[model samples]
Target: MSKIDPKDIQKRMDRISEIFSDIVSHAETVSKTRCPYRNRHDHCTAEFRCRNQQAAETEEAPLVCGHEGEFDYRSAWESNPLLHARATKKLDEIGKAAAKRRADARRKKTD
Candidate 1:
């Protein structure tokens, strides 16, 4: 018969929303960086050279590069304050939700 606190639910929903928003925004940046490794124009100049311009184009994963880039979201997220904040917030929200769910289940079993 305990009423769920509106403020608490709002906080949970807000946390989830922020995480999802950040994930989406960062994902877009990752995608933008996924251009063809080898273009006639030769746009990319990262440490990991894009030699995939010939008949066969093979590009290494961004993680292979020492620098943070669009392909390497983990690195990007780490370096970018906004991205880092978003990722951290998202993780905290997930953890909180999981813990809350566990406690709710326990309460239901006991009830």
Candidate 2:
């Protein structure tokens, strides 16, 4: 079994962190409303719930998840100029690995 390199993992982790920080900062600046996912009588149907429950309940507009309430980071990320390119590049690295793994599984089944 081939192990993913620690350095590679660390790089990806750093990139992800940068993206997360950018998103949080952007939300804080642009968002005047509370998080929509907090303290609802209705189910928190959104993919990601707001960590700020009090803000969600009281604020008219909540800082919603990037993926239209889905837990994805791409939506907010794409808009950010500071970290978008690097984040997507890191994501591509992961995608390539996943593709390789899938191909390997197919090869094993055939053999």
By TM-score, the best candidate is: 1
Compared with the true structure, what per-residue lDDT tens digits does model 1 show for residues 1-111? 999999999999999999999999986875665543323354433323233222214465222323234353233332434565687789999999999999999999999
Report the lDDT of model 1 for residue 46: 35
Per-model TM against the reference: 0.33, 0.29
- Going through the candidates in the order shown, the clash numbers are 0, 1
Q: After best superposition, candidate 1 residue 61: deviation in angstroms?
A: 16
lDDT of 2 by residue, 5-105 (tens): 99999999999999999999988864434333323443332333334222334456554332334343333332334365677789999999999999999
lDDT of 1: 0.56
Candidate 1: pairs in clash = none
Span of ten consecutive residues with least summed lDDT in model 1: 47-56
In terms of lDDT, the poorest run of 10 residues in model 2 is 45-54
